[model samples]
Target chain A: MSTRLPTFGNVGLAETLQNRRLLAGIVVFVVLALYPAMTLNAYHTRLLTWIMCFAIAAMGFNIVLGYTGLLSFGHAAFFGTGMYTVVLVMGRVGITDLVAVMVIAMVVSGLVGAIIGVLTVKTHEIYFALLTLALAQLLYILAVRDIGGLTRGTDGIGVTRPDFFGIPISELPAQIYLLGFYYHVVLVALAATIVLLWFVLRSPFGLTLKMIRENETRAEMTGVPVLRYRVYSMILSAMVVGLGGALYAVLIGHITPEYLDWTMSGEIVFMALLGGIGTFFGPVVGAGGFILLQELALSYTEYWHFTMGLVLFIVVLTLRENGIWGGAKTLVERLNDRRGEQ
Target chain B: MSSEPILKTENVRKDFGSIVAVDGVSVEFYDDEIVGIIGPNGAGKTTFTNLISGALPLTDGTIIFDGEDISGLQKYKRVRRGLVRSFQIPQIYDEMTVFENMQASVLSRKQENNRLFTPTHRDSASVSETERLLELFNLEAHADDHTEHLPHGVRKVLDVAMSFALEPEIMILDEPTSGVGSREKNAVMETITEAAVEQQIGLIFIEHDMELIRDYSDRIVALHEGRVLADDDVAAVMNSEEVNQFILEGGV
Candidate 1:
């Protein structure tokens, strides 16, 4: 038997490919970072911040649904849990540190995610989706009813901006400065999230999740503890989404029970599907596109939701289930193939 | 050769609401032997293997592997203890490349599947093991191709190759070359048996091809109607009249 391991022939090519992808990612982030300065439109920059928040949440949704093949329709539970955690902490505990608040929100939401995952990971398909939806709806009702007088009923409550590095954001000289500073905060968060997910998806744990997604039985026979991994994915995904919710709470400066509603869960799913479920960065694209389309439709007509529905229908029909990002990728590939042929 | 059997089942039974698919079958398998299981259609050959691999819960009986009772263990737990199985229909990750398919097994064997942050490609141990298995199975040329697009024979070889990556003390294969053409059956069998002997891993395979069985198996266990009819050396069992009448004559 040969004692030496064989070397991979394509190692150089693979490294070059990875370097190119890293370069592309850096370029994208650079453009995003420069957008506020170039446009000088505080309103538009703030809108982009909103998009980044949803992008983070939708990416979390994709980890479970697209990567692990578990369709969860109650992601709002974690999102809202994070939002509410911020509200409760600032209101009751009086801790207004942005970083501390976000961490607390994530830890609390992750615990909720763990509980839900433990309850629902054993179920499959629509049962899993419905169970999650049902559980989230229960939380929504509790918030609406002001359970234990904590949520303040359905009329909702306002949130004060937390301190950034001990500097009060609300005491800023102008609204643009405030929005710009917050935009950069969210920008940093989104960039960090993208890098984190990139590393995760390339990891062995991530590959095992993909294997489970492809064939659960085969994965089990190959010695994977399938259920345990599913739960871990759920907890990680929820924490990511929960972080987005923490950011959203500060950005919007308000809280409502509707954030926990099943409709919000559906919207999260729509973002993932629209961006192209299973493809990294697709959910981010989906969130930006969905938000922009909704804003455009709302400005044009009172029946904005109907317009949004029609667009979703058209996109689903034309894109062949790849969503916008995946469809665009396929189109580019086909175009390159044609050029090669010519 | 080791004085004690590596795997032993005590009157293992499986029932699907009184159907009794695998009825009170017990067998001992050693780490240095290749055992061929032969039976007619619906003779419970697959079910018996499934019981051993913990794919299905046994209605009754105990399975002791390496002298530890594993009857209540989960399928993946059994695999983690060096008991692994491949399916009849070539169960593989269709979307993954052939190299990745093999890498999954190696990752599991190294207990690295739970690693959350280490890049899989950088895991030199798993990557090299995967490459070695691809070469051993003569699947190196198609390492980059997705399993979905590969030919059936290649997929079969990949499935068995993946099982080999687990470094199991005992490997069970259900019809390892079922879908391959006749011309390539011997080649596939030869590659499998050679790898088995080289690795010093015991192999239990179910096959309908009598010639391949006679050539590859050190011993034969003939099952009929969910019961063992013959358990002896390949030549002795192959020449038995009961084995011939029940399994071979029945056109398995």
Candidate 2:
């Protein structure tokens, strides 16, 4: 018998392909980094900052929704819970550090995600989506009704911007750079999150989750602990979204009952779908498109819902089933094929 | 070969609400053996295998693997204990490459699937094992191709190859060539049986193809209406009068 370990010839080729893909991802993020410097407009900066927050949350949602094929309509519950956790921690403990608040939110939302994931991950497809929606609604009602005097009922609460780490706003070099500084912080956080999620999604655990999405029964028989992975994905997804929520709290400087609503959950799902349901970067694109569309529509008329619905309808009808990113990917592939032929 | 059974099921029964799918089917599978289970559509061959593999809850019976009572164990836990099975229809990750499908199975087997930070392709042990299985199954050329795009025969081969990557001590295959082309069926069976034999892995497979079964399996168990109609050496089981009337005569 030969002592050499056997392998397919294409393993090296696959690695090279992955490396190119990684390079392409870095290129995309670097372009994103230059956005603030190019625009320099405070309004655009704030909009992009909010997009960064949504993108972080949406990317986390992609692990469960895109890779794992679990359609969750209750992601906003985690986001809202994260915001609430941060708000409560800031109010009660008087700790105003953004990093500390983000950590607390992640832990709290992660626990909530675990509980919900354990209960609901067993159900497939529509039922899974509905169960998650119900769970989110349960949290929403608790927040709206103020169950234990924690949320201050429907009136909600307001917050002011806290110091960035230990450096106060006055300690900043210039007044114009203060708000932009927060945007930069969000951008940095978003970039780090993308890199982190990229590594995770490329890992074996991510592959297993994708397998579960493709065929749950097959995945189970193949020794993938389906429910466990689902919960883990949910926890990881929730923590990431929770971090986004913490960032959002820092950005908006307020907390409201609407943050915990089922509509918020639906909005996250919309962001994912409007982008592309399956692709990793699609949700972030969807987040940007969604926020922009919402802003543009509301400015034109009060029927922003109507405009958003029309756009969604058009995209679903015209684009590839995978969504915007999938469509773009297909377009690029077709172009590449054409070029190769020449 | 050792007479000590690797996997044994006693009075295994499965009831689908009103009907008994698998009725009191008791069997022992030993190492270095391929047991062919031949039965008609509703003869409960699949259910019997499913019950043994913990795919379905047992209505009434005990499944003992390696001298341990494993009836309560989940399907994945059974797999961890080196009891793995393949599906009738090829089950694979459609979006992933053929190599990735094999790698995922190897990772799951090694219990390194949860290693979030560790890249799967970078795992030297899994990479080597996956490539070996791919090369063994003659799927090296299509290693980088997405599984969804592979031909039916290749997909089936990949599915079985992935099962082998799990390092199953006792692999139960349900119709290894149910949807495969006529000409390619023999090649698929030959590859699988040869690999199992070389690895010293016990195999119990359900098949309608009598010729392939006779050619591959050392022992034959014939089922009729959720009961084992015949169990003997291949020649004896094939020559049995009852098996001839109920199963073979059914024109499967």
Candidate 3:
């Protein structure tokens, strides 16, 4: 409309800058890979491994929460469902292969996710969030009290490491566990899932999800099927979280009723907030930060909840609109701007 | 031009409780024509356009587009059939760059938005088409800038460019220059008119500004109380006694 509009620079330098940012991301991943070796402590290795599992769940949650603009407080339903599926299949179906168990878990979780998504997609914003939370709590109740025979009720079920293509992991030398072999397996899954998600985020489907996030009406008018895509997103997100959960079951060797609780969903949300909401790999950073803070707080006192609450309050107050990665990104951008001026 | 009608509504009516918003209004539009819809407040200019664009359902009537009845089509289905509409408030993605904004439309129109493995930026065709529209709308400069960071006028132009990227046969703009600066109103209308003529796409726009309506539209459809008061060439509509007294003179 205004020809006098200032001509902003195009993608020439911006593309190069994006590539640099990607390179920085890869460097971070490399460092994360080398972390267990550097720390050389089993506790730290196990802690980091658990952090990876949480990060994976957070990453999956980001599809709905960050990209699609849906705040889901029920992702733990999918996470716990995935782990429970693994345990059930191994116990009832006599599935001994870890991959087969994970595959089944992912499928079962996806079906559950689709059912929940169908019921919830019609509502939006706070209502959608509330519905997801309610449905998740329904699953939690089923796991904890209603389905005691199948789920072991409030006590939960113990998980045994299954064979990997005929190789019995549970019978593996005890030294390997001490050497963090399971930790490396978790890391590999985390890395592979991250790469897959990165591709998805770069895809046209991802762009459409972001468009829905930015403006739902505009997206609908532009020929984007808002409801259908959202359902797909929910299923995909659930699958990713389910996979993470399956891996988590393998890592922890146990599944508890609390795994499906609403608090677990809140923890996932906190992890996303700890990292940048929409930024790639922000959830991973957030999970690590969240876990470290929780561990640190628990070490000092039993009031870890209060300590965690205080830390979250500080973050929300100081950071306001962004998580840790977003804050760091802003700082870097500011530095770059000053450098350009010079 | 073949003179074949690109879009038509027959006895299209919409009622809200006891009040009839669009009372059996029928109009025919052809390709390569710019039709301006002007009316006083509560005249149903927007309501009629909403029905045509599938934003709202018709209480009773039939909408024929390209010789097919599309009265029951959903908004997105209407868009897929090349009947697109731009919002009066310019609904562009605030967080996305201008390039991404246009690319979303381009991708959706191509039915390539479901590809989960291929990166959106890798669609060179959509990218090139988006760039062409941006250049046509004089928005190439802000293609990489986020829509929120751009000026309101630039964002308006980007909104139109994104619609154009959908390759619509007919575009209904609620207000082409409603929020545009007074000085740049001519630029906005001129750019839109020139692009519509160049692409030979049918255009219908709602406006309250008399001068802009008179200057850019080949024909004008004036509405009053949810009914067509005048439908003729711009000069004829401008000279109509009813239109003059009701709309132009602000005499309800």
Candidate 4:
């Protein structure tokens, strides 16, 4: 097909890479799939659990930043809100139910998103990022001051392993037993997010988001609800971020106002951007790379954010981002371009 | 005819603080008809269009579309009911291709509840119809052309084509042929007219070129100082002494 714009390597190459959807899936699979290899190392296994938490959070951030072209600085609000919700649901409500806690966190986050959207959905460009960040700070303040009793304010909350679906999580050792459980749980959540988001990007609504990102006014003239869709996507995305927070609280046995901090939100934005934005698998790459870097760097220095910030700035200024996984596709495209030129 | 007004604006008034931009300007649009609103800059032509398209909140008045009062509804909701508007210049996704642009609009016509999860391919049967629009607009060759690379004329045409893909009951084109050279003006008008006539869609266009208003629009609404100085057949509106004076000097 001699279409006006050249695509990736015609049908022959596209057919061969038909398995490319596994690009993100296989990475998660390999990491989690091999957790049993370190059955004896408790510390290493525990570290991997934290990796999964940030990965889920990064996945959520990628939805709006990478796909919708909205850079949200208040994502940690939803993330931490979910964590707080989980703690309150578990401790105060006498509900040790993981499913119930997750559901509640998602609902709370969704409501928070709706409220934030009402204030800021219509604002885009640099204004959008600033507003989201402000909203995130609001969450942090509320956690520290407004709900001190329930949230434990600055001290945060401590809890034990969750009783997930009556799965007896406490009986499972932090290192040996629950590693498999966490590996599975995280992989499942990540995979489900990828599939769900992929569906969204391919759907009409996703197309509209991309359109709104590219040209808000044109999208409006087309009869697409520019503000509503933006708000809707933001809310849905924030809800997912909240789910990440809930999952994090369960995985770490803790919830804190720190989770609501803009710094935490900024880190996810870096993950979304470092891997690349507007590409399906870009933020996943950033999430994976960031987690790995943090894991490796912690052994040497406590100030890993400085190192990451340097890397991020370099990438932003110099790198012609095709995104992380998108980089591979770019290579193939460049090669195809050379061939076409010849 | 069946008692459903294609579009109706009753006592639509909008104010910017102390400045009244649109002062109770009432109008109606019908199926298969093209109406043009012409006025100088800041004549409230754009503001009036924005009000009807749900882009701006009116200070007062109700807008009825197909017998439904859509005065307070959102812009996208108005579009969902087949009331759409286009901007003066073509606004497009620079990263995507021309065909993708048309498809984007075509798919919106079938979006359910505006959720982003459902597959749009369920309605891919309409792809051929969209393709037919591309070909009719002489855009088939440039279907894959990135919007950034499109000539200004083609971009404007693509913008109009994308608007048509929505197949709205009434399309408000804000300066459809604004920037393009005279060479491509006829081509743009040809496509716009074809869609408006075939789909029985009502078209309201704003043009600075009185000649085009004289030629294409079934009727012309002339605004002077945010009030309709003339709303009549193109001949009468153009020949009115007040209109000639307003154009030659300034608002009445």
lDDT by residue for model 2 over A1-342, one digit each (tens)? 122333435567556557887678768767767766776666887888899899899888877888888889889888998889888988878887767777888999999999999999779889988999999999988988999988887888876556656878635654244345777788888888988888788788888888888888878888888889989999999999888888898778778888888888878888888898778788888999999999999999999999999988888788744778888889999999999999
List the candidates' TM-scores in order: 0.95, 0.93, 0.93, 0.86
lDDT of model number 4: 0.78
Which ranges in model 4 have alpha carbons more than 4 Å from their true place? A1-18, A23-31, A38-44, A97-100, A125-127, A145-148, A301-303, A320-323, A335-342, B1-5, B8-27, B59-73, B113-123, B248-252
> Can you list the residue pairs that collide in candidate 3?
none
RMSD of 4: 4.4
Expressed as tens digits, the lDDT of each residue in A1-342 for candidate 4 is 223223333657546556675555666577666766745555666666666667677777776776677878889988988888888887888788667778888999999988998899778768998998998898799888856467778887886566778878768766544567665676677677778878877777777877887887778777676778888887888888888888878877767788889889988887777777757777777787787887777778899777877777876765545555566678779999999999
Best-fitting candidate, measured by lDDT? 1
Question: Model 2 segments beyond 4 Å from truth?
Answer: A1-40, A170-178, A336-342
What's model 4's lDDT at B234?
A: 85
Error of model 2, residue A156, in angstroms: 1.4
* Poorest stretch of ten by lDDT in candidate 1 chain B: B116-125
Query: Candidate 3's residue-wise lDDT over A1-342, tens digit each?
Result: 332222334647666556875677668778867777787777787888888888889899988988998999999999999999988899888997977888898899899899999999999999999999999999999998846589988877888778788877778775476345777777878888888988898889999999999999999999988999899999999998998898899888888989899999999999888787868878888899999999999899999999888877877677754778778888989999999999
Task: Judge candidate 3 against the unseen true structure and give its global Cα lDDT, from 0 to 1.
Answer: 0.87
Worst lDDT run of 10 residues, candidate 3 chain A, spans: A1-10
Model 2: which residue pairs collide?
none
Give candidate 4's error at residue A137 in angstroms.
2.7
Name the best candidate (by TM-score).
1
Q: Model 1 chain A, poorest ten-residue lDDT window?
A: A1-10
